[model samples]
Target: MVRTAVVNRVQDLWVSLAGVGTGFPTGGVRVVVAPESRLCPPCWAGIVVLGDSGIATAPDAATAGFLRESLTGRPLRSAVEAERWSGERGVVDVLGPASLAYLDESEFRPATSDAGIARLPTGHPALARLVADVSEDDVGESGIDEITSAVFVVRDGAGVAAAAGYRRWPRSVAHLCVLTSARLRGRGLARAVASAAVADALRSQLLPQWRARPEPSRRLARQLGFRELGDQVSIRIAAHQVDSNGDRGQPGGRRP
Candidate 1:
């Protein structure tokens, strides 16, 4: 039941991002004409086009102008090409690559409630420790502020074994984030906590979005029933403008 609702929500978000009057561009390039603010807050400035072929425009005018020129005669064919072009043109310093994906709530299997997994209220004391276990830069993007509605944690004798939760995003999307302590690696704790968070997201009628740097993270998303929708590159105007959050932005031109 939740699956159907999530699918509909995903469609609505795509429509909004694509702009009100425009339809999908021909030849597999789906252009999002709306401003970045109207789309995702983390995205600063640039054209974020996603579809069979995904491309992120450079944020700065000069690099953005160059990207427009490159795309005038040819459409971006693949993420690899996008990365290659940026590197060759020295635009990699300004643009970061990322994978876009959404959970297939239809395929999601509810994990049996585990006694070890505990759902905590926002601002719980334990949350501070869990956040500390992960990268400090991610605290903001984790959405653990006053508006956070749900937080799930798995605790071991040492401390937080893993944690997961979602932040509200535009279009009723749940921006999911997860973290597992280094010592607990390979224990499936990440998946366990993530499952709890996803279940909560569905119960609240929110769609789960799993956008991250492609790789092990993608593998984890797949394990939790997310499928790749497309890819995008993000324009970074300054080192600080780019998010250091694990799920949002990667610094130093790291592919996310």
Candidate 2:
């Protein structure tokens, strides 16, 4: 558990530094694009500034202190604090890693390919809805097409269950996004799909990193060959509704 937490913390720090952390911009708000093996859009590590007072963008108790000092031109106790704070407002951040582990062939099993399992292109319209279903803030877009990454999915007759994808950038990374429908929880679809994704990542010389908010998910990732990195933080804000036209309730105070 500690190992997974450490890996997560390191991943978070790297993402935060790369500007793709939780509170950073996704599509339109990008300031700089950096190398990341993953397809996540480059984001800002510091606070995301807004044009108007719309959402509360304050950092956590720890991050807030760092922000106040940085803005006032005070000495930083550590770089970690500074990385979490900047002039940017309206963005929430979870900083740190959980645990990390390396992959070995013996620890993984090759999953048989299913003809029904098809790779979903990143540009596919179905992707937008899948992302939206998870959370409004979970989706991001980039003008650079090559930077976009996604996975293939397998639908069991009626509902979706398994997904596998990867990003080859600053570092090679694999993504295993699996959700079992109400009727398919006990089956081994997730394991099969996840193993397949990791196998692909290894072939491409990429590191496979898994994200699980709950302990059980973390445990599963370890069992599948991912080791603990560290624990990180993700500060989530309620996503306000955008009008049917996609305009914010308050003019111009939104993260892209």
RMSD of each: 8.0, 12.0
Q: Lowest summed lDDT over 10 consecutive residues: which window, candidate 1?
A: 247-256
- lDDT of candidate 2 at residue 57, scale 0 to 100: 26
lDDT of 2 by residue, 127-242 (tens): 44444344332222111123244555666444345455655534345444454333444566656656666776777766665654546556667768665432223232223323
What candidate 2 gets wrong by more than 4 Å, as runs, is 1-106, 109-116, 123-150, 234-256
* Alpha-carbon shift of residue 131 in model 2 (angstroms): 6.9
Top candidate on TM-score is 1
Q: Evaluate all candidate structures by whole-model CA lDDT and list the values in order.
A: 0.58, 0.41
lDDT measured at residue 152 in model 1 versus the true structure, 0 to 100? 84
TM accuracy, model 2? 0.46
- Residues 61-142 of candidate 1 have per-residue lDDT tens digits of 3433444544555655543244654543323343435565677568775456556898777677776666676665555444
Best by lDDT: 1
* lDDT score at residue 138, model 1, on the 0-100 scale: 52
